[model samples]
Target: MRDAVWRHVDGRGAVCVVGDDFEGERQFEQLGVNPFVLRPGEPMAMYHWEADQEDFLVVSGEAVLIIEGEERQLRAWDFVHCPPNTKHVIVGAGTGPCLVIAIGAREHDSLGFTVDEVAKRHGASVEEETNDGGQAYARFPSREPTAYRDGWLPE
Candidate 1:
């Protein structure tokens, strides 16, 4: 697990479970699974949607969910189900680290990053609508492999 840990340029962290020999690349064919760790105010990813379905479960701490232009508070054990093209993003909230388990289809016909005002308010939106990840995250640093830290999950 530690070997598959990585830190995003934006300070979010994640454990890519089905990675390629610790390179943090998903190795699965049908689905992908990851556990994301986020500090307060940090977003798990840009506000975007895919052509396939996705699901998320809050494992610990708290988070704020921005979906389809609305905001909702999330706590431990909260589960979110997103059908195809349901735009959304999750931001860390409360006083500590937020751990969320994300599961989704590995293949999709399309993906898109949206320019959402609500996501922007939480620093999680792209400057403009785009399907390219590089364009959507142009202002952020790249993710790098990192040593796993303790306490990212509940004991």
Candidate 2:
């Protein structure tokens, strides 16, 4: 397997395995896959919905799924399927690193960010509703490319 590439937002972010190489084609045309590594209380992304279907699998550790204003606890092997326009976000929980595989279809103009009270409580909602990702994460530090380190996963 190729060494994972990382991007950090306030010390937490995803370990991108599929599109790690930035010098060449970095994305798939029909779908996208990303493996996120989050610490306790860290959110994988802002609260949002997409016009295309998206799915998530809790590969290791635990997470809290905030979906449609409800919170659901998730553990390893748990899977979540989100249809078009299903509002959701995942926050790391439990005592260690949470590994989640996020997969989604690639459709044109397919996403929108939202501000939700439930998501705000978990630091996962944008300050204002917008379709632009740059505006949604404007207040936070940029996701700088970084080298992957060991121990993000268990032996």
Candidate 3:
């Protein structure tokens, strides 16, 4: 009975977790791609990467995607394809944390930033907040996190 779930993990990003494939392997599953909230009037740093293999999609909110040295704004329901090793980065432009869902042909080692990984990469202190379900969510403060400039873009 596996289905998509969006239970509140934490308020940090309030990410709505979903699955890539309705029915498939766990490792190959693509979870929601999210980051810290983006406040208006503040521009978060951007990161460009050459992903060995993966693709990204903007399922909701407004995302400013810098792909192949070009910047474009993506609104709700808009989608962008970053082929393997292509340079790309996305920044939230709308009035909330942009919710992104990525589908990959095969799961890559790293799709985006995990809480812990982001903290470690940026050398920031992460605070853990527990939800009603007891799942711990990590939170950190960074006007500009390292993830801003370090992400794997799909070729």
Better of 1 and 3 by TM-score: 1
C-alpha TM-score for every candidate: 0.90, 0.90, 0.44
- At residue 16, what lDDT does model 1 achieve? 46
Per-candidate local distance difference test: 0.84, 0.84, 0.41
Scored against the true structure, residue 92 in model 3 reaches a CA lDDT of 59
Task: Show the lowest summed lDDT stretch of 10 residues, model 2.
Answer: 11-20
Model 1, residue 118: what's the lDDT? Answer: 98
| 109-129 per-residue lDDT for model 3 (tens digits) | 432321232322322212332
lDDT, residue 44, candidate 1: 89
Tens digit of per-residue lDDT, candidate 1, span 92-133? 999998989898886775899999999999999998899998
> Where does model 1 exceed 4 Å of error?
15-17, 20-25
C-alpha RMSD between model 2 and the true structure = 1.9
Candidate 3 Cα lDDT to native: 0.41
Stretches > 4 Å off in candidate 3: 1-26, 29-46, 105-155
lDDT of 2 by residue, 1-155 (tens): 23666776763565566753566464677788888888888899889999989999998999999999899999999999999999999999999899899998878557899889998988999988999988987777866677675756656
Rank by lDDT, highest first: 1, 2, 3
